[model samples]
Target: MDKDDQPERTVTKPQARVVDPPPDSEATLIRPPPAPKPPASPAPRKDSGNQLPVGTFLGEFEITELIGEGGFGIVYLARDHSLQRRVALKEYMPSALAARTGPLEVSVKAERYAETFDAGLKSFVNEARLLASFDHPSLVKVYRFWEANGTAYMVMPYYEGVTLKQKLKEMGAPPNEAWLLDLLGPLTEALLVIHADQCYHRDIAPDNVMLLKGTGRPLLLDFGAARRVIGDMTQALTVILKPGYAPVEQYAEVPGMKQGPWTDVYALAAVVYYAIVGKTPPPSVGRLMNDNYEPLSQLAQGRYSPKFTAAIDRALIVKPEERTQSIEELRHDLGLDTMAPAPRPAPAPAPARPAPAATAAAAAPSAPAKKGAMVAVAGLVALVLAGGVGYALLGRDAPAPAPGAAAPAPPAPEPASAAVATAPPPAPVAEPAPPPPPPAAIEARFDPLQDFERVAAGQSADFGVEAATAKPQFRIDRDYLSFTVKSTREGHLYVFLHGSDGVLVQVFPNAASRNNKLRAGQTITLPPPQSSWAMKASGPAGTDHFIAIVSAYPRDFGAIGLKVQDGFGMASAEAVAEAARAQGGAAPLFLGKPVCSGDCVDRYGAALFSSQQIP
Candidate 1:
């Protein structure tokens, strides 16, 4: 095959100090710009590599035009037939790593890019999930997204406007301070919302901001979470940072230099600095190497008020530690503090339980409690006896119980008052009770890891764990492991993965994402899309087990000698096992039964799942 015939290979690095051209249409809708007049005799159009052509249909969406294409995806103006509205549909293409095999099917360019491709794909879905979770006006909203045709697509409202970069060019001058403040207000509020949820945009540049046509409402665009993951996997460092806009910590993930709210503060301030001075403050990395960055206060003197300029400079500080740490602080410095909304309050702690005596006495008379307790005791006793019986059965083929097996008795049935009150004549002959309903399956248990089962000893209706994949099986080194964990009540969640290699790592509630406190009914996705790490399938191919434990209060893993590393707690198997054996106590109880709260050994709930990583 001729070289030109082969799938076009494309890999474009992010440009430093380069202004991205405006898209054919803005990312979202403010009454889309008037469509260009079609030519009288249009020429036939050829496929633009992997891009879907105009008039292509994806489910209910019919592609009307290709509005934009990026290193990672293609943005199209489409008609959502079902919704009867124009929408901006984004398809995860990743030009460098994938190619169009069929009209719609996207396949990896080569085996080399497969892993990176899949990682980016997962991140793309995560990004959609992240966007869907928020409702702030300044943040881009995702109507819906789905995986299809060997890739994925997200539907967003079709928007029409000029990018900030385009707006600056059209005006041929820097925007005024008043205008900048109007833009900053909403954006900062949006930033605060995401920051509160532990997500950072990481990519904030002029072209990524859209100014709606008439209202001039600034809408943030093109979240870089998925792009960052692609960069990390491909070592395409440029894709991870826009030189002049990205802060020093973003240049490299150094120890003691963490990216957080301060990171976004710097980028937003840099945008302001650019708008005022017509230049971004020196690239953060370059500034670090040689301190040549001029403060916006000095650079924009007489052009903007001292307070406004000062706030921008402070946020642009090279060291995050010395910078304006939050949107609130920056807004305050800019003298727009009144415009900022109050922060989302943390989840309230569960109300204090009643005194133990009062609780027990209050709960004692409930027959449901007695029944629940009887069921719990029966389950535990059944589990132990079943295990022994199973062991005995495994050693020999006979269905008959081993000689000592008969010593185990079925759990005594719940007592009835009428039966107890009346004396019964003994039956002449008692038929052997039918084998005790095969020892009812243990309830609300983590069976894969005996350790987890030991830790949370009783049933809990409040905790749930389910795998993301249809089957808990992943192709070694090809698939990513995902699952959702939810606690019906508010609690701290700690999830640990016991890898096929026998390495135990605490995947959630780690150093980077310490906000493991889950709110009631909140479903948390493991390797959260906004999370700094992911759970990719790797070799040593066998079963990998996960244990998700929820506690009424935070449990200190330090006491068990687990230490955080790379956003995960590296735990010694022996230490974890020992802790499980020693600390595995019955779950808390209410109404004479083991419940998720109230009196008992431990106030916790745990669930488990295991996935097979096949070669």
Candidate 2:
């Protein structure tokens, strides 16, 4: 790539300047001119080794025109046909080491670049996955993404907005405290949400920040989690960073150089400083060496609140520890004290009931209470018996038996009280219903490699072969394992963990885990209610495997008919492939094959299937 054709970048590492005290008078305020916007993208590049052709289909998205290009990738304005709407599509085309072989495959230029290329590919996919979890108004939404041809692509909503830097350029001056506070307030809260998820938006700058044209809401765009090896990147040291906005920690590659919320704080503070003064803040590296950059407190006296200005200055501190550590502290300094914190997890479940305690409590009341009631009832019963004997003898008019003499027989003459009543017997007591049973642990689903190998025998070389079968690395034993399987393109993920002892467990779409459908470029993880496979039970010491089969459409696992017993399901993957092939369920890719003109990716169901051992 020619230097003139490449995207315009700012990567100056100017010599350190002498330190000076901040200005106390307005006359000393030396506000710099606004930084220039990034140069317009050149005409769409041709589809060759490392680029996609215009009109090529990436699952649901159709590439329309190249919109932007950077050192690592290209962005395109595309149409999402399924929804019939426009979207911004980003493609990972790291031309430094790899290129596209077809509209669906990538080839590395050299063997040495393989690991670095794979690392960047994984990072791009991971960036999409992480951003998918966020839904803030001040954050761009990543709808979905997928891999095809040789690189990965991310689908995001195409919004109308100018970057903060561009907005400042048009304004010709710093925005007032009213506009800044309203914008940065919600923006700070959004960063809090991102931080809570344990993520750092390492690239937060005026250029990366956008003010939405529709609502005037500020969105922090293009988070830099896809920071990868710089040696492999074409732009030397500054490839992953915006020089003036990036913190000191980002410049060094030291092992203990930790980055966290504090790194984001520095970048965001620099953005605030830029909005106040027209120019970019001095780079953190330059500041650390010479310590000569002016502070915000000195720059804003009567123009902004003292507390707000001070917080910004503190956050701009060169050392991470001296800066405001959290968004809450920053907000507090700005006097938004009553704002609520982010939503937290629900309270934990109640502790289990102790049987002995219940039994003891029941026993404590039972004996004493029963004794008192019994005493009262027994006395009344004795009184009734004594009175009955006396009444019968006195009213009978018959003689009682004398001492030592034979007793006279009692008369059976009491046939008088026909109206005498008896109480109905107590209604039979009902027993309480038993509690419902606990949820059944998911049954295992397994597709053996032998079966898959047998099935792939009929498939073309692109479908892979025996040498690629069940490449189990024996790393995990006598411990639980978490698994994730990500497809290069959008498709349904049917995952099965085949234990060493023949137990086949379905990780997705099980009774316990039901997310069988995957979005384009979806990365489904393990232990599914939301994620992928997890093996809890340890079995015999042998090779266990992960069998993943993704198709362009969802398949009915019921139709394939696998033997299911003890909550586990097992079928040969070969049977599945044979079934699919016999049914013409998968598309055939040819080296010199005649290609369809229409959207073939969606029209014909193509599958890229593979299996590997669980780590």
Candidate 3:
């Protein structure tokens, strides 16, 4: 397609307004008339009656019907002549308003227009570059990209199955547990690869995940909103978040809150919740910021396991800090935590010392024995020296040889006597033992989600009741918890958590809500704190469900303190007893009263309470 031959775009004008000049005399300053309207650039010539459609052919692609349109451009189904395959081609739309607006509007629009174009082009190029770097079965493949007539388009493997959203609508809200389990692993794996590449798919929803016609795996699509993990800065374009599925941060205008793995985690959990439950999970940080929602386990009627609900909970925490911090953490919440940790390099061994070589001189034979006459003379001299030293040292000890002089050598031993003495005492012999091998260190591995399941099952066994159906499961860890539950009866599931006090802590609604249904196979992570609510069918009218109750004792010490005042004629103990009775002593108390003395009594009513003591 030639640039000049493309059709001219239509531009809509803003509503016109009449403004009155200020009454001040200076307002009278005249302004020059606007320049005569330039002849309308003849609308770019349209195709002749017999010409092919606008998106027909470019290079070897045979463009088919338009499949979708968006703010920046349109997408078309096309055939790749070279490969004989179908593909999706996204083309950018040129701005026509830029030429008609006033100077300021023109400038702003021009900048935005340029930005949109650049961002789209950059995203197309980056997505291709990133996706081309890996070949995960769950990720859509980008084959090629190019520009024609000043519009850029990327060719991606066309998917035939309905989007998760469409499937959800068809199935109704809250699809079955079997559906959730099947899709969780593949989606998680896809996310792991994406994050590993340092890219974030800002837009993650059921609509972007397509269930391929004949494959079990779901293909993640639309990298147009994906952004590189560089700094805190968000992509130049407005962050595009699907309202119910997007985390609160995505809705913030400030760039600092825009991009992070938590955003994707939230979206992922939403999809899961929608699959298991039939409705979107309640907002954890938005309107339901206050802790006042039912637990996911109770809500789902124990249809899914608690561990599953906990996984989704952690993924959707309102505070990113409270949510799953990394992809590995999210994976762990799902049953897929068994993945081997990255291999660590072994440590280098220490160098060994070389042994010294034996010397030739030391190993040589001893010299021959000296003459017998010399030995006899030396013995006589030694005898004379010993006798003289003994006589001189009679008063104390024998005198020693002169300090600097050498001592005389002894005579050679007799052969027979010497041999007998030498052989008489043999030194004791000792045996040596072999060295022991090095001790080994044991490595630790654990999956809390799995552990919870075992524990929950064991507890249920004690009661002689097997889990009839897997309810949403949840597992709480130090920083986060995750769980899953049904959001709607039509299979629009959501996994969300409430604080122990019943406050909604987080929610992850399924991305697909069009028909409020979900496909049979879908999975999602529940938000954290091991707290969540799962929606369940009441079974037409009446069905018994499990409910966890925690009761605390009320403390009356403060009331007793207040009764100790001098004004109370009765004893402090009696007054406290009466007050306790007045306050419904046996009932569960959520608050308590403080000590009331002279001043306190005057300021507050006698029966006024201080802090509500938890019972």
Candidate 4:
């Protein structure tokens, strides 16, 4: 067979030698095969029912599903149509709005209420404005705000991660310093931004802090509760606070006690404590009153270092005067480099005003006249002097004849000669004006809401009512928690405690439905209500938890009857008295027969026994 016609067998091998071009050649050698293209990124998944589509428009964010509900308002997850991004939208709840609005029927009355509501709404606007004002990497960015369907909402960058609360619950606690530092750095940065704006984040609980999924940067949420340094009278009425996180002053009636950096410091320490110990630090106010709190070091089971313990102790001081003076100071104590105090620029000099040129020019003309007058007088004096000299020479021999004529013989010098002898006065020269007095110094004063340090132990303390209408208020001491009942339309206040085991311990009026009214301005200090279960059949040692006090006005008490279940779950009158005696002593009796008969004894016995054994 011919070679050309025969089937050709070709062996394939990796190509090594492509012809190399001369170094100086302009023509390029064959390019290497195009680098393999990277695999395309996966498309983002579209949210289904979970996507919030309400209160939003196409190309605009609309809040759909509510992610959380609280006493003040509700938070929703939203979608930003324009940017195709998810955001968290917090809005006022209708119920909370109604509570704020009150029940005024007249237009004028309603208008007044509406005005107050609008002012309150301004706080939310202020929060958004504050968040908008900052551009820190740690802060959650606020995009926009608007009202729709009589509802106000704010759009913020959506974060897909659990809150510090959930994180604590899931992780049980941070394991190492690195983990805690990583968490706190962003939180502190966010706080620095807040303080820079001269605003206090009245609420700084773990629930208000969010951690981004991939990035660990903490995003602070719910500025709705934040307030400016100036008197926020409205906040007094709202009294937004978390029992565990709020410092002593937060529960104060006076506006000054409600907020400041120390307040924030206390809260931040509480959050850090929770992160480290898996439980909130004891409230400063509660601790001061009860003196029953265990220190964070003890709570941490010796896990926390002395430095960490001291930092938290300083922050959680009961008195604001004893706490860290500023957030920067707190950060410094935490081993972070302190932020440099903002450098103040030197003041600019006062602008110079030119002297009036016209006046100076006019004065210049007058100057030559005075000089010419002097010159003319000088020439005339020279002539007069020569004549006088001639006359004196002629009269010299005659003047010797008489003693009285001797003086005249000397010949008086001419007035012009006197002028010629005097040198012309030098021209006046203007001297530069003394620099204006240094500008007045700017005075700085302590901001009661921002500058106070938490007071240390052994500091003096005082408390008084801030609101006009008398309601129930409480103060704590080492051995007892005292409550003051303010006289209002309502007659009395009741103090109770709900134990950890669901047993209701009535400390005040032992019997249910007892009507007691505390007079207005009257202060009452009662021993901490005694618990009947304290002495009853012992099971295991359990912690005794009780409500400090619950206040009910005359009308509210009458309107809402006491429930048997509320006070130890419906035992018969005899059984209740017997149990009360067994536990401690019998409490003051009141109206309403017990709900259960002999069964009451069994129920009460079972509950108390179970409570003692549970923990």
The sequence of per-residue lDDT tens digits that candidate 2 reaches over residues 28-132 is: 111121111111122324644355566665543457677787757878887543233466888887777776665456678899978787788778877786776
| Model 4 ranges off by over 4 Å | 1-59, 99-115, 226-239, 253-258, 338-615
What are the per-residue Cα lDDT tens digits for candidate 4 across 1-615?
Answer: 001122211110000111111221111112122111221122212442222234433112345456776644566775432222355776644232333221111121244445555555566656665676576655666554433333345556555667778766776436454456555656776688788867777788898887655443466766654232112444542356676688888766465464677778888888887777677766566777775655776666566577767777678777777778678877788776553322222221211111111100000000110111111222211111100010000000011111111111111111110000011113322234454321110001110001000000001111111111011111111111222222222223333322222222233342222333444445444321331111121212222221211122221111011232212111121222222222221111211112233544210000000111111
Error of 4 at 182 (Å): 1.8
Worst lDDT run of 10 residues, candidate 2, spans: 358-367
Better of 2 and 4 by TM-score: 2
lDDT of model number 4:
0.37
lDDT of each: 0.55, 0.47, 0.36, 0.37
Model 2 misplacement above 4 A: 1-50, 230-235, 253-257, 337-615
TM-score of each: 0.50, 0.50, 0.42, 0.42
Error of 1 at 529 (Å): 44
Residue 601 accuracy (lDDT) in model 2: 45
> Which regions of candidate 3 are displaced past 4 Å?
1-55, 94-112, 226-239, 253-258, 283-295, 339-615
Ranking by lDDT: 1, 2, 4, 3
Candidate 1 clashing pairs, residues 3+ apart or interchain: 28-158, 28-159, 29-158, 29-159
| Residue 37 displacement in candidate 4 (angstroms) | 38
